[model samples]
Target: MLIVTPVTPVTPTKTNFEFEIMNQNIVKALAGIMEKPGTTKRDTLAISRRVTRYICQQRRHLLTERHALRRKARKLRQYLPFTALAVADLEQQASDHNAELLEAYRRVLAAYGRSIIHDEEGIAAALGFDQLAALLNINPVHHEQAKREGGETLQGLVFVARMEDSASGFADEWGAGGPLFEACMAGLADFIRTCPDHLLPDPFAPGEVFGPKLPPQLRMV
Candidate 1:
């Protein structure tokens, strides 16, 4: 009697590339918030909240889809004798889908980071943040590192912005309404009003550094 052995599919694991992709996505998202259409503090805050909510919604949807695919693949694998090929195919699809989602996320983060670094630097400088930082002895080494490495520094800014916009009264406690804050708001408003074109550059533009490298079917619509 000849016996056939069932082949076990290798479990999908995250690679360094996936981590890099996620990091890029986060930076681009922060840049997006800074580039939103808002001049005054109120307007900028509102726009940032809305955009952040939208990004969260999209991420949740992608996660749900990926989870469902993975679950289905696992179920299919149980019927190994009959479903080996199908299970493997399903696993591959799930992996590809995840990669696509990561790529989409990365594009957003890179775009947002570039917008802040290239488009909004002038606004920050004009608002006297540079001088204020100098006076407060705040080292901008993290900011410089974010510009160079596109890492967690950008994500940290997003967290700060969220906290500032929260209703916990933290902003008030931190003197968020001070002269420097007002100047920052006013400068942002002026930048938005004057250079609307530069705020949200297309991250998926052809030949762009962060453009979509995935196939059309795999890319997020």
Candidate 2:
């Protein structure tokens, strides 16, 4: 259906505010999936839908948190040394800010408590990520939770949806990935390889080849 890269957790842009919040909301809701105790499912679509629906308010939350975080981080800088400092002072402020940040995200995460996994197996088959049914571990998931913790929400939703859709279509086209997949892969490779590394603009204009249709400055014998 589509191909795209996932957006970051936090974005520094004006237009993508809502999407940022939705992504944060996702991290909040599927935190369990990221936490030690994780989700149990074989279907990617169901999982994605479940995660997506919970953050109806993601857009708002992202901006609010972003502004709040920037303000707090600024405050932390005043307390920084970029040099050695007393153990107690460093420990106190670091611990304090970390807790504040953690609690803030946790509140948002809790917002997505039961919204994951709606249609179950249907979505998994759709995305073709159904085979990745097992949770390899929690830390990595939590790390993913952290990575997308502050990205543009709308972008992420769009991104994942596109990948699933693209993969699904490709699967159908090549019958679960074959010549069609290779063709697409080859196209991308060619694009990367043949694309000009850099092209400097010409300094001089070309001699006038023609005024409109006839050649310019031509002399008949």
Candidate 3:
């Protein structure tokens, strides 16, 4: 007679790593639930909460990175207006300044990378969907035209969705109400926690809002 030993699974130490795997699991579970809608609210919420916690952890990681990138992107945005103005007011040196501005824009894109694969709006643009990008209010055709014309009229150059959108997106999904909503909303709250005081939007004056309204929370920046 022979005996067999069970293998022990290894768990990731870093929360991000754990969440990354958990995200896949949650997506699969959601798909399974979609196939058979008889899942109890308690079970659904339990799964949603787990997914939400994972999302919160991922958002925290992005938030930390966002602080640095936001400043860099903002600076790029500021330069675009200035460069455009220089082109308009001081035509001769416009070519040189435009080159510099283009370089700065490249840097911002390189820094942002394709990490936002989960977000459809971002992924589409990141994958070079110029028309879709225009529709998404990210790198709109008018902005491109303005860039080509060297004009400073386009005010909303830098677009980043507010933290609230991410949670709301998941909550707003059909057949994902109740506990799922609470879970997603909770995830957004966690994202807010990672934000610095400066990043936090003021109640009196909100930040730039772009992307799908129906999805609720799905930002592309």
Candidate 4:
């Protein structure tokens, strides 16, 4: 027989890490929910109707929260246009299936969860490698129109989230961010803290970072 001591699991220091993972799960679950209805399977129209009301209600609540945050000088959510963007994507999806209403609501939810993702290759070229790699890891790159050129141009909008860095005395300002958005700052900090060397953006090795800055022949967007 052997005596054993209990070992404690390390708590995730960064909150957004958990937040993003949860949100991804939510997205997957929503897809499943929409595809199959309860009791009597929701016909496409019925599902569309249900989702529409759900989004409208969520939008109102979000608007209220935005107002309160603005009033209190807290960081206002900059995702108002997000829903609009999703609307555009969902419209395409709807057009594919001819589900007008369903597309609209899908757009709303999609925008509800839009963010950017960029590696440090460019930012390192401008700022430095260390800072770029420090950004939080969130969403993937958005492929609207595959660019034939200018690889450095960011195809993602990384969420420039609020940082809890005591040393970073910056205010929580919300709005558009540069193309160099790599990840949520909170996650970035965690990445740097835990895995400083095992990440991307090894700019000193350019070929490894962004593939030798694409040839001039490719027309970039």
* Predicted structure with the largest lDDT when compared to the true one: 1
Off by over 4 Å in 1: 1-38, 98-102, 113-221
Question: For each candidate, how many residue pairs have backbone atoms clashing (under 3 Å)?
Answer: 12, 21, 3, 7
Residues 70-185, model 4: lDDT tens digits: 33222212243434444344333323332343345445434322222242323324533223223322122311111222222222213322121212322234532321221233
Question: lDDT order of candidates, best first?
Answer: 1, 3, 2, 4
Model 2, residue 87: C-alpha shift (Å): 1.1
lDDT of 1 by residue, 155-215 (tens): 2222222122233333445534222222233334445556768575564575332354344
Candidate 4 or 2, higher lDDT = 2
Output the lDDT of residue 98, model 1.
56
Candidates' C-alpha lDDT:
0.45, 0.35, 0.37, 0.34
Tens digits of lDDT, candidate 3, 1-221: 22222322222369857766676677567647734657653343234334444444444444444344344434444456544433233333332333453443333222222212123233233333343233223334244542333212111111122111232342235423222223333433444566797887543343222322233576899
Candidate 1 clash total? 12
**Which whole-number lDDT from 0 to 100 does residue 4 have in model 4?**
24
In the order shown, the candidates' Cα RMSDs to the true structure are 17.6, 21.9, 23.9, 22.1
What value of lDDT does candidate 3 attain over all alpha carbons?
0.37
Q: How big is the positional error of residue 107 in model 3, measured in Å on the Cα after superposition? A: 28
Better of 2 and 3 by lDDT: 3
- The residue-by-residue lDDT of candidate 2 on 1-221, one tens digit each, is 22222222343476576766666666555544534333444333244344433332443354465555455445545544531233333344444443554454343433222122122233233333223222211132333432232121211222221122332343234323222122223333344455675743232334211112223676899
